[model samples]
Target: MRITPRPPETVAPADIDLFDPERFRSGDQHGAWRTLRETAPVWWHERAGQSGFWCVTRYAECERVLKDYRNFSSEHGTILASVGAPDPAGGATISLMDPPRHTALRTQAMRSFSHTVVRNRTPRVTARVAALVDRLGEGEQDLAELARSLPMAVTGELMGIEEQYWDRLAHWSAVGLTPEDPAFAVGASTAATLSTSHHEIFACFMEIIAHKRANPGDDLISALIALAPGGRPMDDGTLLLNCYSFMAGANSTTPHVINHTVLALAERPDLWRSVAADETLVPALVEEGARWTSTPYHLVRRAVNDVVLAGVPIAAGDWVCAWLPSANRDESVFADPYEFSLRTLPSPHLGFGAGPHYCIGAPLSRMALGVFFRELVRRFDGVDITAPPQHLYSNWINGFSSVPVRARRRPAVASSMPAAREGACAHGTS
Candidate 1:
């Protein structure tokens, strides 16, 4: 599926079923996306059971769709499942709303994951991640599983859930987001499984909400409960949906970025050593990983009115998906788009998306990534992939299903450890 340098003016729509669940099962998706970007920046994708949708492949076109909510609206939904259909959440989720109303809900939720809040929570988050790293012990481990544990810990803390529930919460989050994924497949009926799993998760959230209502605390649930939109506390149903939103936001996506960052940096010892030596570069490394991984490849939007995007006619009521991963790798937007570098990146990536529907969990995500990588570089000199990583067969999430890797702890320097002094100096501390 690799796109040749010179592709045809457009792709054969039949060959590329953008809605196919297996489309992303191999390395082919990347090339397929590249071809779409070059040949049909605004490509049409025909779904088997439903009406066809347009895929906005280039950075400009994707950003245009994301930013211009007037023409391309998210009110229908922001994922492929909701295309040409009403959002199951009934647009109660902030990510599925348009301006004004979206702004209010997003603002309320952002308070819980604001910069100051995340900065304050960093120490606990870091300590939690460090403990997880230590628990990795001295053997080959599935880095993906280890990475998955992190958001559970952090999000668990934010939601005031017991640590024991983290694993189940993570599982539910995965099953909820990608029921079509083989790991969560219970039978031929994925939608039914997802529906049942979501209800269970919702019940858990209701319990948390009920608890928070009676005994409010300094947790995200409390903050959300305290949130009053249009002069009244947000409804219980909205609260439940948003709480689930926060969990899914943190649980499902961040791990992919973490796994990708670890695998990518681990493979490049030179880059790993540079970051290990200087902690300041960790942010850049994290940013690069988000851009490189593009966890949620594309977000769905529906046309509110007829529009011409990149010379293609998109009719009113048409479903469109803005390809974020493709946008991050757009040649015109990024120099040497394929090369992974920690240096200052080109135009900021749309990994967390854009406009009013931008990811509110970004601050928390950064905190998790920052702590995870910093701890990883500080503790392990090398992370070698002992076996090929098993990738998730998901069109939405681009990540490792299992990354088997051996961790090589940094050798302890004897008594007057110059390495310790060098590390301190590099980190600018005593």
Candidate 2:
């Protein structure tokens, strides 16, 4: 199935700039993406003083680029910030490597984030999520702030990080990914902020690595310390880079998924009531939320060999970016792509990505979302959006810096009633 091409007059292609943070912040990127997807699914994006790249917006093309790692190398970089330059951490970090090494490192890391591991940790995760949910006041509260603490708390103890350092790590991860956002700008400039964040996070990991080396525990860091993938032990540089990768991956996307889910529910009262009445639907909601949010909006890969994508000839060493959010909303792949519906089960959306480089932390992120929403529906009757969400100023992460919400506690009677009875009551049919 092919997307119906839109009229050329409808979209001003010259004004579209995929690298501009303001396009995303102003929410104009969605329209631009739609235009691109329909008109030029595989289009060249040029910028003055920088090398141009191909933008893959449709579902099939995006998936093809991600899965075809041989032709499209990640060794150069995985974000536009490093475009036209080699990433120092490229071959060393798990996120920036190709197979064999990538496979070995991911296999070692997968043990800690496996479904069994996440399942075992669920009870504790649920307890923590419940406690956090219980602490919310009745009036307006920043859901973004509440969401930020979750991934750190869940992954921190799993990684043997001290509880006191979770908040700091979360802050640094946010800043590192989206330093251009004023909310995270502590240094003189965006580059300075990014440098400071990277320095602090690496230093923190170094200290943790030293402690783990002395007092090894049943945790990820310790396991990595013991792991000798390919008969070569990991050096501190590799360890620190992977540690930063893990922390950033764990902390960045899940919170935005949570915040976006709540905000979506708040806007759709009927959907909120349905999920609130039936906790079983929470999993479906979680899946749909991940699809809807599509955080980490785009991923960049440099072509290792010349290849033709969607009829467009891409040359060797040319950078290619797959717009994940755009792919998730492709008209041919999703029916009513713009609408948020829980019925989109068995979702083929590239939310966690596709192929060998798929996110290793996916199971952990899914577990956190499931536990959080289950606890949320049990405690809250409904949530209301108090104001517009403050979106993060970055083309990389499709997330909010602030989401003000007012939640109403579930009534005592409603809490005690059965699911069917609660549904009936919610509909005023009793």
Candidate 3:
């Protein structure tokens, strides 16, 4: 089942409601985003009985808002759900805090995701992805399941989270992000589902933190426990909130990028064949995949003071959202932005975002994607979609909940190639 790309719609600013998850589900939102980018770059999005927000769609404007942390505060919230109210995790978690404090905590957190650490872990990640890819049998398989497992495995190991808790944490992370989706909803109301999932994750992390305190290890939690920023240790609440932030950030986004990329390849078999013939193209393929997916679709920030963006006046205390997918597709920044081609080297897409809040896990994410796709094309001739992807019903996360596919396993003779044999055995011995 080849999924046809949705064409952009000619929508007026008044018809656009960035808060509606349904539009994203139907792919109509792409048209709306396109319209907003071309016509109203800085749009005041208003809906009945809900607070309005300044939606910045163009690349230049979105980059400006995200980088200008002093003028726009994240403490209020980083998603539309917290509009008109301060985020509960505000000031405690890295994503929700502004600079000085955010700077200190992020600096400490960076220790876990440093380039050296990620590079050292590459062989292990490659091995893990290879094993997972190898498990896919030839008939039909849900690529989403494979996509979901890799991140949890890599991130859980880094945090020293026990394997027994990985599955539940992955589920809770999904639920916490998209409580409105019936597939992930745990309770009657969206609020209840969100609360339940968050509570479960927090409780689970508390248990892990307790264990780490008694028996420290070389992991993120243990590192944070030992950290003394500015001569003061991070409090329990802040520590716990950061743990949640780390897990959610790791588990939620990367999997979707995997799904979207695989699905894109499935749709374009010619591209898949090209990638299969050349191993070196994998890196560019990974970059193109990240740019095309733009999984963490939009990030919300509140204005600290009155500001002018794109000739539009945004009042102090107003909500401002930077649509990453739109910015990535901005014609000015990317040539033929919508085309999923490997030619765009050094992609300037805001897939990981920009400035102070750029994703810390980006290196790990790129490594995982590169390994997965490189191994995937080598092990399988190609993949065929068996059903249309079921996209998550959320404005925040742009991903599929299910992508049913049938793998075409490569012939055994193909494994005789030196590159194929090398990739198969590339897993590091730890």
Candidate 4:
């Protein structure tokens, strides 16, 4: 459906510069977002110099929105921050789309990202992750670089793409996810960038699909292509859109989670120290980081049917952003939500989202995090950092281009560990 921006007066107040990506990038946004959650849990945010959105801060209200698909639709493409960005896929990707169409295509695309697929691809993933850690010697260093490299490289390898394109993939993924910052807004250029990448990726997929069509292989593309809905093959557009959905928001979010998780550890030494001591706790650390980082902080939902949340009345056509970073730290739900805790239990964090739209790649993300962190932590006994991490300026991705992490020579936790103890990282730390 074509959507033209309504008149300025008709726009909601939540659309404003206050939600600008630059503002959040300049500083950690938790404090301000937290204040709003408490003071005006469900408030309108219309600021000068930004697209408008309604911010839902409290956990209960956010839950109400996520679980009740009828009340809030995920079809609007899931981002309230980058209101102006154009999707190169012609319309909504899976995450942005509502069900039936979204569900059918997602079932195929999700097959590639399934746990077995990610597990099958782990050896390669582990090698890249370990190489990154090996370069950083034991010392105080920038955590962001250490965090981002694993997922950035993983995204490429998993897609069967060459390593050369990791930088561009990371860039696009970051840009698409965060819109509250100074990162370039979506427009003609974004479409160009997206189109360029899509062209390459689609070409690659088309080749693979054709190969599978002619001579079948065990790779995911083949399996997806083999899928027959009522004895007919999946169409090109559905297949392409499904694959595109996998690469869209995930690639950026993965690295951002890694960067933020490590950063969180650095800040909360207690948490970091705990995870380092017991590698088993690393999974919890990963979850906490993903929850706290809130790199892809805003998730948009359209009112599927009129409903009320947090005592606020809603109507169909109205849009809402479940400010996840804020919701994850809801005072009512978490004890000292602002305080980072590796020991936190039964985490109800919305990092992977909730209900049907909950990220289909949850297992892949979890597996990646498990392999990346466990191997790194186990290998580097004295994997101390070199210095503080730098932050990226992009509004869509909370990450760093460079983090100078030169670590000391710690005993190898395993035989095949990637040492990024020292090297040139793609994105620098803030």
Candidate 5:
């Protein structure tokens, strides 16, 4: 008689070490996302001790939910419900806010983030990327150290936060994003992490705000300081809220684009080779890498009214999350969804989000990554992954925590030596 092996106990995507934060931080969990994206395009998941939610796993549906924000409002919490500390100062969750109000604030921000401003910074951003890569010396370097720093430096410049405050800002951002970890919530022998960091960092923003008020400049801080809508100055509450929003937006997303793009290209020699052959391919690489990077995995939305999605009923007050990363890999929308292809055109990935609330800094982030990666492949002779890339301690943002790389290139080689650089590798980032 033949006895079959026992099947492993199936775990829900919401529960499958997905929220442990540490697992993602350490790079242990993988592949359930692919399974979810395929089998349960939009499935309901239940978590122990907290409210469950509908996980939207396909690109077609994810785009629908994100673009039609009116039907699926995001004004509540953006992801899973917290059995932990909620933001103490929470008035409106900016990321989750519905439009009209969201539109007003976003418009104010667009004035500072317009296309020309980002284009002007490209050279400086390219210089930073070059210097950082040149410093690598073909040895194992923490991708986080270089990748994380570039975005923080840019945020520091944009926010007037100063270099001395950069590390502290990074710390708060990690804590602020990673709530299930020991950082955010207060408990026995500890105070709420958000409370502690909010007071300290918000105070720092206060100084910047005050300084800009007295002596304005071309930076975002000064622009926000001087901006008044409808002939009334923005109140202190809205002002602080907008400032904090910018910090959360830029610092969280930009670094991920850089870290994951490099990791993705290093893992897939073909795309790297394309960039090596033609630096112009950098833009496509940037788009596809970011498309694959999968930041803001799910944009959770509250049902604004009774709505039907793909014939499924969504009751008002119910929470639904659009699984964008899963969507990007949807086999329906993509051909051989898991493979990295820089040549794929008319690509429709939801990494920067979609519709009215689509990320305002997208053009900036895209240009920066394209230039950075182009310069890297152009300069380095050999770029290889030395160790498995690690991911951050959050479920909301799908990005690398660490990507160990060994990029080989003759330091003194001619600037235009080879038409292509990536020779051997495997994997994708967006």
Candidate 6:
């Protein structure tokens, strides 16, 4: 989608500048969003120079926005920064397209992520997780380092990226998502860093695409290239955008979920012990973590026509954002919304979102998380959080760049030396 200059619409009430990145940086947005969900389900945020947008904070309203794409259309953009951008990849990309087009494009990519595909790929995921666990040191280490690196390497394998290029891919993805974070910056300024990273990412994909065209493989890149959607080969630009989307979608959110999962478990050794005892609970715990973390906080959409959401009038051509964190924490939907628990299995979490634009990598993400956590339990009895988690500086994404922790490998007291001695004595006597 090309960036287009949009005329300022009628000003929304200045209750809060939801666009203010500082709210997220300070980690105060959750409280603010919770309050809005109760008091004002549909709140408007006006940026000083930029046009204001409506925020749907309630679960019902957010779901309505997601499902009613006819009114709340992604044709404009699905991300805050891309709205009104001339080249939003509206028609070409699955994410930015509406019903008919979106359905078709999504179908093309959906096959690669089907139940069978993910099921067949489980062994690879398990091996990857086990290898990662093997590399963990005995004492204090940054859990976030493993959290950040492991997902990228696994996702890189899925995308057919060379092992050597995994770090570069992670760096580009980090800069792309959190350009505001100085740690991710490539140059002196965030803007320059984002620009350089985006250009490099696109250039790298161009080389990959060229190579894939020459030599087809089992990778997603080759699969997309081989596909003739509507009996015509997809254009190179659209293909490149899809490649970027896959990388961003797969690499950005999962690490945060993993980090948050580790932190949550570390806080409750009882819960950790339970998971270590029964590996079957790992999948449920993974879902709960995704809900609790709300990694992908919100997704943006534009109003196709004037519509009232939860009694709030949204004008045609206005922007609408669905705050996933607020929805995930909706009291009406989730019992004890703020409290995280494995019992909240099969949660209707909006972490992957809802409706047509739901995350395509949901299955893969779940598989990867389950494998990681199960392997974690096998290797470590528990985690000891070493320091406070450092969150990423974006309102769009609820993620942490660093969460320090130590992986403790000792078996529980119940199953340690005494039990081992008894077993040895029994075996010798027998």
Name the best candidate (by TM-score). 3
**Over 4 Å off in model 1, which ranges?**
1-14, 345-347, 413-430
lDDT of 3 by residue, 288-375 (tens): 8888888788989999899999899999999999998899888888887767888647878889989899998998888888888988
- How much is the lDDT of residue 112 in candidate 5? 69
lDDT of 5 by residue, 116-183 (tens): 88877655555555556665654778766576666655556655666677777776765665444553
Say which prediction, candidate 3 or candidate 6, comes out ahead on TM-score: 3
Q: Provide the lDDT at 235 for model 5.
A: 69
Off by over 4 Å in 3: 1-7, 413-430
Candidate 6 Cα outliers beyond 4 Å, as residue runs: 1-15, 83-87, 412-430
Please report how far candidate 2 places residue 297 from its true position, in Å. Answer: 0.6
Misplaced by over 4 Å in model 5 are 1-31, 37-39, 81-94, 179-193, 229-232, 411-430
- Candidate 2 lDDT, 155-208, residue by residue in tens: 987887887788889888888889999988989999899999999898899999
Q: Assess candidate 6 and give its TM-score to the true structure.
A: 0.89
Using lDDT as the measure, name the better of candidate 3 and candidate 4: 3
Clashing pairs in 1: none
Which is the winner by TM-score between candidate 4 and candidate 6? 6
Give the lDDT of residue 168 in candidate 3: 84
Per-residue lDDT tens digits for candidate 1, residues 1-430, read 1111122234454567666767676553656677888788888787677777888889999889999999988878888877767687756777777887888877766777789988877666766666677655559898878787778777787776766667777877777777877777754788887887788788788887888899998777898888787788879998888788778888768989977777777657899999989999999988888888887878988899989998888898998998887898888888877777785844399988887777888878877788778777777787778887877777788876788888887776212334334434444321
* Global fold similarity of model 2 (TM-score): 0.92
Best by lDDT: 3
Query: What is the C-alpha local distance difference test score of candidate 4?
Result: 0.61
Off by over 4 Å in 4: 1-18, 47-51, 81-92, 108-111, 114-124, 138-149, 152-212, 228-234, 381-388, 411-430
Steric clash pairs (candidate 2): none
- lDDT of candidate 4 at residue 161, scale 0 to 100: 44
Query: What Cα-based lDDT does every candidate model obtain?
Result: 0.77, 0.83, 0.84, 0.61, 0.65, 0.75
